[model samples]
Target: MIEVYTDGAANGDPGPSGAGIFIKKGKNNYHYAYPLGILSNHEAEFFAVIQALELCRKEFPEEILSFRSDSKLVVDVIEKGFTKNQKFLPLLQKIQEEAAHFSFFFIKWIPEKQNFHADKLSKKAIHLNKS
Candidate 1:
């Protein structure tokens, strides 16, 4: 199984944001940071997971994926396979679609303290945003 830790950060509630992902496969580790122009923090969090899933699809297809995130909202929404919030509905749909490509996809909620690496990467990504 591959372990992936993901996080998202924004300068403000609806400001420049970024997604961070840390992937561990055996003894190897991979890191990624993506700048997203302008989005809410929640939207960034959802995008982080989406980015990770996309990466795994290309790098670890058909592999079991164990995803970790500090955002409870993102975790709950993905785990339950449903969301009522209009803003998140499309993001949720994208997640489900991406997840279907993997044979096994599992997501878990972790404390922010446990997600330090991804947190730092996300903050770095925020700085990378030009606008």
Candidate 2:
């Protein structure tokens, strides 16, 4: 199965932000980072998941996906039928809708400390976006 782990960071809740994702399949692994213009941290988290799904669709079209994220809001909305806060409801719904395009997909919640790689990249992404 193709595996993906993602995370996002913001200097402040409504500050400059970024996202990072790590994708792996067997021995192959790849990482991506993106600058997010001013936005909330939660939005960045949502964006990371969106970006990961898009990349997975493009690069691993034939494989099943097992996705993981450290954000509870993201994982719960996607996997557990948790209703998002109204502010996030549309975004969550949109992500869920897009995920349906995948042949197979699953999401699991992970603690922030266990998501080191993604955290590192997201921090780097913040720095990169600054310059």
Task: State the lDDT at 54 in candidate 1.
Answer: 94
CA lDDT, candidate 2, residue 59: 83
| Candidate 1's TM-score | 0.97
Per-candidate local distance difference test:
0.94, 0.84
What candidate 1 gets wrong by more than 4 Å, as runs, is none
Q: What are the clash counts of all predictions, listed in order?
A: 0, 0
Tens digit per residue, CA lDDT, model 2, 1-131:
88899998899888989989988889988888888878799988988888888787788877788888999888877776557388677777777876888888888998988788888888788888878
Error of 1 at 20 (Å): 0.5
**Over the stretch 1-131, how does candidate 1's per-residue lDDT look in tens digits?**
99999999999999999999999899999999899879999999999999999999998997899999999999999989898999999999999999999889999999999999899989889989984
Q: How close is every model to the real structure, measured as TM-score?
A: 0.97, 0.91
TM-score of 2: 0.91
